[model samples]
Target chain A: MRVLALLDGTPADPDAPLIRVDDLGLLRGDGVFETILVVGGEPRELGPHLDRLARSAAMLDMPEPDLAAFRRAVDLVLGTWSGGPEIAVKLVFTRGVEGGDGTPTGFALGMDISPKVIAQRAGGISAVTLERGIEPGLAERAPWLLLGAKSLSYAVNMAALREAERRGADEVVFTTSSGSVLEGPTSTLVLARGRTLTTPPSTLGILPGTTQAALFRAAERAGWSVEVAPVDVAELYPADGVFLVSSVRKITRVHTLDGKALPDSTGLHTVLDGLYESEY
Target chain B: MRVLALLDGTPADPDAPLIRVDDLGLLRGDGVFETILVVGGEPRELGPHLDRLARSAAMLDMPEPDLAAFRRAVDLVLGTWSGGPEIAVKLVFTRGVEGGDGTPTGFALGMDISPKVIAQRAGGISAVTLERGIEPGLAERAPWLLLGAKSLSYAVNMAALREAERRGADEVVFTTSSGSVLEGPTSTLVLARGRTLTTPPSTLGILPGTTQAALFRAAERAGWSVEVAPVDVAELYPADGVFLVSSVRKITRVHTLDGKALPDSTGLHTVLDGLYESEY
Candidate 1:
């Protein structure tokens, strides 16, 4: 693993102690983060990831991110991990030490993708639907809720995934209080039915998935129609195919929902994988 | 500020960077925390705070916290700041470096209470009611959401408070989607109706407040009726008095709700303050 800390746009020694216990990011989980895949020592989908990071920072009322500082840190960390297998480069920016000038703490870390995530891509995953406790169409009215912002307060998301695992499932798809399919805990829910691809709209309080956005762009070029629509849980089971899309995991087919198998993805995987591979 | 990092029953250097970047507490906000008021070098309401911490740890599936380790760290940190004005001592425990043996990381830090929070006690806070984005009765069914747990994912709570300030208010009182008053961002909601005190039930997904619990016990002994019930926002405006109760802020009366002055809290404050002081 390689890490580089960006102190006010300057790269600091990775081995030196950097984070203070008083950082609001650690103390109150007040921060924003983005994970980009590095292929051949280069950050993939850099533009979209940086854009989302800035948006998250704005939602959290943190100062606008210094993208140049982020780029420097990413470049340094990736260089340190050169020649490694594909790595996940994570960019984190937090409200700095409390009672200070509120300078943001920014850093980048590069590490090999978790084997478990890689396995999910190859084996597909069994997903269970869980209630997200909030009703649909509430995100817009409650900006203070920090909906659609990828804030670091992800304990609920992690807990939902753990709940799925305890139920003998590998992943989770969250549904709103109204029984509408929202999105996966860490991934976007994209469904395909008869050549049309559909994903839940970000207006429903889901993080706009970077990989899903990339995949949609690629899929569109490959002559597939993509739509952002509200999906009900009942619609997922009847869909011809469903997949969870994320940056690190890329595109993963949901082999089963609850306990029943969805349609197999023999040809769809070939087409989607080719699109993802040809992107860079 | 005095800080101590406890590693498995041992006190480590406070200035040494204790948390790794990969700590799930920082990465996923997978942690629990408590802030207790230290008066004259003694932690007030220690038993209830620890009990709440243990409950929070259990809600997050963390290993049992070694209370002995916590006590030792607190003692050392408090001793470091002996004779200082009353301070706020914070305890944080997180599921340590992810994918490891799940060894928890614990720490204690003592700092003088923020002048702003101390000022609130003198100048009562103007509060606003904001929608909490969830129904009142959903927490029990959605344990995965960790609604009642004082998990570290306080981004939304903090955001709500910021939203209130932006609207020219001093604090926030969260209301459920059904219009029931929930709690403050970091405090418990307590409303005074004559000699009876009512608080929103914990079943409504609000954290069970340590200071609020202590206040209720003290109130009962002083001939005040305490009821744990769900309060609607409508009732707050007509109440005899309203207050946001927390350990650090002690018992702060809410002077206004949504720009409208609540009833003057002369008698209620006298009684509650007397009860609070008599307890300690």
Candidate 2:
């Protein structure tokens, strides 16, 4: 089941036409979006996702979105959703019609979570590392690149995932030109080395992982060390365990990288899962 | 007046809703597009633009767009156009609605050329060079980056143009990390030094400029030298003249580059303009 709502809290038919031909969001991908996970009819980490969405909008120099309206739209979708406990709600805000006034096009869409996400969380996934083709240091120096912003121009990210699929992998982990591990095409890279959990810092131009941050904060209170630092591709092979974290996908263990089987980390997985559930 | 047509030759209301909320073109920018200049009801270089559109689709691993359908759509829009002598006809092809049996979404839109484009063509433009944040050699090595494809994922390109606007410039010329000149945000870089016309090679992962190719082919026959080579930022300072060329904007002379006045080439501009008109 799927539900749709306008930013003004109006319910829209999901299967009907919803966007104009001249919308810049469709014409030039001039937009920002966020996907949040819903459990038991409640959206998880809604505030953080909204914050990041605003940050992305600011990075694109777009007008700031109305958070109060977005909250109403989300509530509308959730109230209308009659499906399962788990749903993925996406908030879309775009620089609207090309020749019209500067009013933005905004909407919230709710749908059932993909079976693939559920399967990956259960049985893990295989991933391949692909070159991101940009230097890590260029992120801060080149703000126009929009490296850290979760803009709707994700064709390259989708292409990277297809490249991974062509290589018989389920996901892609993007590495900088200098072989520094950045993040996944749609998730954040997390590596566990015994008692420490480390992820690449957002300063490297990758998105700051909301799920990882929440988990890390709770883990610190639960007596685990958390570190944010640069990670290298070579470090993945020797790590105790590796995972990809996202809002909808949660934590998915990478079972094999480049077809090399990795040692299982059943104990750590349980601990991390418990931490995430308790924190949320 | 503006006109819109579906790929099947059906005319549609440009002001009404024409896209679904789940269209990947809107959600993820997973699509391809072409903007062709129409003069006297004729689309300039239609064949080449369609060829490039198909190539971009191939690069994105998308389903081959139906060219015959696109042709009919373009013809329909042209037939219905009641605009002035100049119009910009844009063809958009997307990956289609998410989870909807793999059907693609496509449309052709025609609108009057922007007053800004006309103004720039008449009086020229000021441009600033911005770092593209990628190595020149990465184009071939990183195909998944979609460097050569003119995909709809243009948020970064739009951002670069905004950055140029912030610097009080009308356009942006992108340079590689090592200071090798690439292309403009929406145009191709062409530098004239004496009798030689030079542009950066398309092998550098930039889109092969259809307008530049047409201009070069005509210039060679007009007894002018043409070269496709790596251009450095330093070369722009000593060039006889610099221009940005595109299908819609046509040829726009860069009056000032990075706030420095470039040498005038009135003779060459007239000669090149004549050649382009005669060839087309």
Candidate 3:
């Protein structure tokens, strides 16, 4: 079977079967995953990505893996064939095969070639706010269950993106049923109100973003206000600027929401670009 | 590295590596995983496991894997592996690896040797209810995010179970602070009152368990009433009989919870044991 293999930053053979699962993704959605973007032949924000990976691994009950080994593996790929343009890097982990005898089969890990680069919307993505569709307060109570950690079991986020795609938009800006804005499916939602850049608190079960964290620091250093607060979807469209931030696509501006066009903001682009320069 | 390989159910070399993630499980936690028990040389209830894996894969936005080969792999192992009273089987999948050009590397998969089975418990598991600690109604709202599907991102469930185990019980029974019961880390809660067998509704975001579904069928054929409804942790100590059901151990009678021993209901045990019967 042909398979897509992602080593570090380069794309590999597509026909080699590289993965097999009993559909653990279907059975329990019992894993965490990561997506890193490669730009100019380098992985962006490796430190933050590793930090988030550690946080996510702790959430899944696995021992913290050797970070040095992880770095080495990525470095190994980098030292070999590099595309040097742009590409998506995917990382996935399961609980390992478990049950019956209560023993662990080793974990299945793989890299996949993804969209070389997200289509950069000329202005930004138009998004719709769904009620987040989750039971209230459970994410907080089950925080230890790794609510904020990026897991391989990302059905809804995938669906949200699909929903966005369906709506002819780039992504969904998740909101509580009660109307509080959460974040995007794959990226952290940051609002630029004049000069202040704000995102939902990670404590609220949004997976902490290495890219967003770095951007916030850069924003603060750039003398831009950065806040982590509860945001309402209703107010998002009117914000001076709105964007999605992640390790791969450092910042993608939002163009429209619910068919309504949003105003332009270059301030966010400036701060985020500086962050990209220093990191990626 | 040594690995016990099973293609469907057939056994292969043990001293060789059938898959390698380069320890990707340590990197991004990017994969889906499952564990099945070998019963009398036959794999128990594999269809449900594959289904769960598919659901999780969809959640991760990976292509749906063809599980037909998995069934054959299990058969391959059962046809070989020759030694065991009973054993556990593990299956895992990753996104494969990527190259320095930012493409996916080959995928890695491995089957683990069974762990020693030592089912020990005097009684049922006791759970402490946390209010799910997040926004209200997140589970009901966000079904797409896989509140109920089993995913490898189980760091928190393991922690929750560890927390429960630390408190002197078997597994953690998760509940929303709203007073609605979710489920245990790994098993679904089955309770009985007289001849009535009951569990929680999946609308609450619990992974639909194949074992539980089989139990429901078994209970009804045995002329016991079966009901799937919302349950709270408080209902446990008062149930006539309680047991946690999974693929491997089949059924383990819960003995003590929060130091309080639950009463033995012949009805519960009868149904529990009856479930293993090939004709139940």
Candidate 4:
């Protein structure tokens, strides 16, 4: 797998030493990142992802990233890579080496999406509800907890996925201590009920889903109502359909949640998939 | 300023590209770390730090690290660095590149501890109370959240320290959502009331402090009573004294909490300092 880095403006060798050992991003996970889906050499939802990355940086109080630099790097990478009608492009900004000037270390890398991820999306995924172990309303009051930021500190998310795999499930839907459905490890939760599409609010400490927002707009235009509400984990079992959505995965149907088969909604998946592909 | 990577049993060049971009440690912040203080070319409390690292790795469900390899790396880094009766030694282990066999990527680096940190030990520091935004007992029930483990996913901890710095304080004592005193961002909260030195329990999602444990044993030997109990944020202001203890920092007194002066306890500092130095 080929890679590239944007340590100082233009793309550099990914094989060289690009990061310092004391970089807080590597040491303390003090950073933010966004993953974009590149199809046919065009980055999907670039603006939204960049916007979210900026917001995440702002929340962390790190330097706002050089978006122009990021764009140039992304373009350089996508243009250079030969094998990708579907590539995953990741943009990362870390609070540089500890005790430095705090200038953010920024980089981007493009890789081909795995055949397994693509297959999981096509066949849908079985998910389990795991306890996120955070209260519902605490993040709104304590922003320093970085609940709304897409920080690189995702050890718990990876552990939850490992637990799911141990349980023979493919993915996870994390719920709050109060049992409110939060979001996925690397995706957002979206549920369809009748003619309305709903997602949990970012106010509840979940990162606002960029693709979910785009889908909501498209659904609104497609004669479906869109709502952001507090969704309980129980609501997922009876919904018309449930999806784990993200920029890269696009949208994956949750065929079974916690070993129970969710209602079949292939028709809903088809409609939303078309809307996501075209809208983004 | 030097570093080394024990990628596969040998100390590899730190200047070389030893990590893949897809390394879960870099990609997902999925890893465990230990920061040890080296004095006179020997790692202080090496055994406890390694034990904690193993426990943290287990908590993350990554492969158990090769302790023998780790010791060799530490010895090599310390031997290579010429400076220091005081050096900061770091051990890091990531779950390796994604889509791989989950072999762990391990490395060690030695650097001089900043003079400011050494001074903070003697001059003491002003601190503030920040909400950890987690409940007290949730971590014990939900190990996947990885609260007790010193996982590398510490973005929130860094953010809280930034907030404290923004508020003109040197450190933070994180309280739970319910206002129970938890621990410092990187240190354990230890309070003195009368002759008893008390610390919050690890059951409250706090990382058990290796230094604090050694201090407690030494304190008992030095004729001070030691206890582990639940402490509220309210108790910090009225205590005889309050401190943040860690392996690298040793013990740092909290001169103030949220702009309120904590009672002076120079005698406690002196006693604990002697105990810490001699015990280690």
Among these predicted structures, which one has the highest lDDT? 2
True-vs-predicted CA distance for residue B258, candidate 2, Å: 0.7
Using DockQ as the yardstick, the better of models 1 and 2 is: 2
Query: Superposing every Cα of model 3 onto the true structure, what RMSD results?
Result: 6.0
Model 2 chain A scores worst on lDDT over the 10 consecutive residues at A261-270
Rank list by TM-score: 2, 1, 4, 3
**Poorest stretch of ten by lDDT in candidate 1 chain A:** A7-16
Off by over 4 Å in 1: A5-17, B5-16
lDDT of 2 by residue, A30-93 (tens): 9999999989987889999999999999999999999999999999999999999998999999
Ranking by lDDT, best first?
A: 2, 4, 1, 3
lDDT tens readout by residue for model 4, B163-249: 999999999999977789999999998999988999989988888898999989898988889999999888888998899999888
- Higher-lDDT candidate of 3 and 4: 4
- lDDT score, residue A17, model 2? 95
TM-score leader: 2
Q: Name model 4 segments beyond 4 Å from true.
A: A5-17, B1-18
Deviating ranges (above 4 Å) for candidate 3 = A1-46, A57-77, A85-118, A121-123, A131-140, A151-156, A266-280, B1-16, B19-38, B42-68, B87-118, B121-141, B148-156, B265-271, B274-280
In the range B1-280, model 2's lDDT, one tens digit per residue, is 7999998779999999989999999999999999999899888899999999999999999999999999999999999988798889999999999999888999999999998999887688999999987687788888999998999999999999999999999999999978899999899999998789999999898999999999999889978899999999999988888989999878778889999988886666777777777866
Each candidate: RMSD:
1.6, 0.9, 6.0, 1.8
- The candidate that wins on DockQ is 2
Answer with 2 or 4, whichever has the higher lDDT: 2
Steric collisions counted per model:
0, 0, 134, 0
